[model samples]
Target: MKKRKLVMGTFGGLLLLFGAVTGFQTLTLESRQPAAKPTSVEIDKDKALQHLSEAITYQTISYEDRTKFDFSEFDRFIEFLQNSYPSIHEELALERINNYALLYKWEGTDSSLNPIGLTSHYDVVPVLKGTEENWEQEPFSGTVTEDAIWGRGTLDDKIGVIGIMEAVEYLIQEGYQPKRDMYFMFGFDEEIGGEEGAKAIAETLKNRGIRFDFVMDEGGAIVENMVPGVSQPVGVVGVSEKGSATVELTIEGSGGHSSQPKDQTNIGRIAKAISKLEETQFHAELRGPGEDLFEFVAPEMNLGMKYVFANKAIFKPVIEHILLQEPASAALIRTTIAPTIFQAGEQSNVLPEKATAIINLRLMPGDSLEEVKSFIEKTIDDKQISVSISGSEATKVSSVDGWEFSTIQQAARNVYGNAVIAPYLMVAGSDAKHYDDVSNNTYRFLPVQITAEDLNRMHGTNEHVSIDNYLNSIKFYAELIKEANK
Candidate 1:
């Protein structure tokens, strides 16, 4: 009876210690809010909307096969920009790279300060052939309905292009002079790898020995219900983008009739290899940008979630396991494996001599392509299957505790007073990656509030943006300019 009582007392003491640790963590959490000095810049809503609508009419579609591009449309779009913003053309020095990409320099009073860059792609993905009729309006009509503007490029990017132009024009009208040099770069072929557009532009600037303080591009945006615990809409700024690699697994061996097949066939081996890879995925651990995301949001989480995240040192494995259950969340902490294409025999009775499978991988910030290849070779553990990998490595992680990031957060908070602004990792590729060599830091964010459904419309049918969202985007750009210069 005395031993039983001692065991119970020890158990109760352990529970009390756990509770005390969690309570202390929650109380000591830091606030993410920054002092915001927003601009009172008034935008001409009607004019900005008209510019976006008209800009959409020109189908600046990018195709993998460059010969299919209609240069006439590109020429017309350039003409429209020249006519639309006279002040920009008159004051800023404009240079055209590769005959289509635009580079504009807005010289500041102080050349001592490093330049700032604002980049956006004008080229858009081609609308699926048969899905054009499914749209609420014609894909290229650029129709402005009652509340929303309907078109292809409205949300994907044209918003960024027009929004920046409108803000600069408004600032020019308000006689607001910047203290730092500003560069507005528009890429013509971002949808198709950006090799000729942004990549070439970055090379040009690097050769000139020019460097920038920071470069802002279109990426993450404000969304509701994105973070688990935060009730307010969170505005995510992407500090690093995941690397993309295409790994091909191929097997070449003898082919025979299905009726008299060998004990092991090419198809069976490839299938087994893929199965093994799916079953044994890359290790999932909470670190780098993924950990930073939770750290920023933990303080704002409810008591229950706050307790778990605040004590992350002890609960990291549990949190990672929970996050790994969802595909979207799993991508945050580990390299993703997706089998995209498989090519094999054409006839049912005959086995093909060669079978090939293509796997697309989105690598974590610190993961190298060579390491990914090694993992696959080790995981499959088959000498017969030839493995080949090629792609870019993950971008360098940017600083979150610096004034540069604080300026962006402050601008977003100043405009979106209710939003919880935080830094995150981007899973997809963007033009921002091209500027990494030319700038000290590159940030990816599009100043707009969108729902999950709206996100789908970026490259899908019925793409649209509301009038209020577009206007707010312009205000954000204008306010960001002021904030960064200050």
Candidate 2:
């Protein structure tokens, strides 16, 4: 009888302890929200859609081989813009760089304030020859259906170019004047790396001592079911981008007949090195913009998830374990390793004299190139297998707590009501990085709400955008401009 009584009491105590722990976690998750209300501005729908459709018809495609690019299409696109937005041409000072790239300055009433810039690329990736038949409409047709507008550049960034122009044109029509200076930079060759386009523009502006308050570029968007626990649509604004690095592992000087092969051949050494790298990946830690994502979503999550995330200080390992289960989430925490190419024996019977493997790495911020190289050398622990690593370092992280970021979030929320706006790290590169030297803060966000299919279409077949989304994106830009000027 005493044993039974003690067991009952112990079970009750355990339940109470679990409840207490869970309650503490829930409280922690409920603490992230902005202090100010995001303001919204009205946008013209029909005009924005018309502009987007017209913007897509030009095959302003970027080619890695500069000579292959048809500058004639770019010239036609420029002529179209001149005809499309007469108000902008009459007001803003337009300058052409390299006869392809463009920069426009809208002088504000208050010249004392540093300007805010909006940027997007005009070039689209060439539609693969065989894949063109898969598109719902011609890649450059710019079809406008009742439900959606179809084309190549609609989603990737013609939306940005046309959206900004539509907003500015509308603002001019409305007689709305901005207090701070505004600059619009359009890159001609962002796809093949913006060396002659965005980089050149940045150098020119930097030389002129034109420092900006902040710069906005195309990146993260409002997406559904992106967060595991949150039900609200999450609008992610990118504050930093991961660096891309390629590591080549090569081994040479081993050859023999299949029957007379050594205990360890060139291929064997290369394989072992690759296996080691895969087994020992970079350490995964929850910090920076990744941490910021959870901070915003946890409070809105269910009780069970909220509890776990709220007490992340104590349950960090558990949260990381859950996150590591997903490749998308896993990428946020650590540098990834992908073996893209491998070369070994040419003939099946004979042992190879040399072997090589190429590893693609997306480095986390603060992880230096030299440090990563040293770590790889130590991990493989093979002196004979030489490893060479090279790539650009990660971009500097921007401040999410500052007014510039908050204003961006606020503007997005006002335009995309019911969506939870949050800051995160971007995995891909953007022209926003080029302006890092001049701007105090650089944010990457394209305020269009989209589905998983839409994401696939951004760089794939059936690329498109709804007429409503196009207009909404323009409204977002106008609202953002108005909010920042205040």
| Candidate 1 structure quality by residue, lDDT tens digits, 381-439 | 99999999999889988888888888889888888888888889899989999999999
For all predictions, the C-alpha RMSD in Å is: 1.3, 2.6
lDDT of 1 at 173: 84
**Best candidate, lDDT-wise?**
1
How accurate locally, in lDDT, is each candidate? Answer: 0.92, 0.87
TM-score of 1: 0.98
Residue 39's C-alpha lDDT in candidate 1? 55
Residue pairs in candidate 2 whose N, alpha carbon or C atoms collide under 3 angstroms = none
The C-alpha stretches of model 2 lying farther than 4 A from their native spots are: 1-25, 28-42
Please estimate how well model 2 matches the true structure, expressed as its whole-model Cα lDDT: 0.87
